[model samples]
Target: MLRRLALATLATTAAGLGPLPPLPLLAPAGPDTLTVTIAESGHPDADGTFELSCGDKAGGNHPARDKACERLERLAGAAEDPFRPVPEGQPCTQVYGGPAVAQVTGTWRGRSVDARFSRADGCEIARWENLEPVLPLVRG
Candidate 1:
């Protein structure tokens, strides 16, 4: 019986009589969108509000949309919020990063996120750099 079944299957394929039924596709990722605002008094050109949408597709006016989206996707698994503020009383270096300030507001991975970033202190600077192109790179 096994030999007969195998032969039958082989004959069906050789006769070009197989086209598997299509499987249903899954839904795309939910809308992950954000509005990023950066302010730099010294560099007026870099100060502006930019839109960023990331999910199955990356869209919006952000200059580095693809890279930003990739970075966001990579960070999705972390337990910590990328935009979260530094913990109160956390030790941070006294070195000044700069005057650049940024705010990111959006819904990411089904959670609402509103994170502020700055280069005021070491902790703040690390938070800002954590997002990379999602937040503009600044030099102090």
Candidate 2:
């Protein structure tokens, strides 16, 4: 019986019949999508729009989709809120970093996201800068 089974297996291999099915015939699932927009307060020419998809595959119109997704992953790991409020009573520099404002609206890991960013104050500036990996300055 053992010899017969071995012969059958050899015969199947020789006939190009394998246990696994072909992978190409199966269609892959789609990725999740995120929309990001940056608008300069007084400089419309510097505004930009980007789209990013993360899941089974990385895609979308974002120039750095992979890097953006990675940054979002790190943010999730730390349970950090991208829209955290500025610390009360914390004195900030009275300087203007820029007039750039950004908004990120999408779903991440099944959670809805609507984060807004600006470089108006010190804390907000930090928040905006922290997300630089995903949202870079795009001068139109």
Model 1: how far residue 106 lies from native, Å: 1.5
lDDT by residue (tens digit), candidate 1, 1-140 = 76866777778778897643444564346878999999982566668999999977899999898999999888876655687788899999997998999889988877777888889899998988889889887889
Question: Which portions of model 1 show Cα errors greater than 4 Å?
Answer: 1-29, 41-45
TM-score of 2: 0.63
Candidate 2 — worst ten consecutive residues by lDDT sum?
Answer: 19-28
Please provide, for model 2 over 96-132, each residue's C-alpha lDDT reduced to its tens digit, 9 standing for 90 to 100: 6677888888876565678888888777778777776
The TM-scores, one per candidate, come to 0.75, 0.63
Pull out the clashing pairs in model 1.
none
Against the true structure, candidate 1 reaches a TM-score of 0.75
Task: Give lDDT per model, in order.
Answer: 0.84, 0.72
Return the lDDT, model 2, position 130: 79
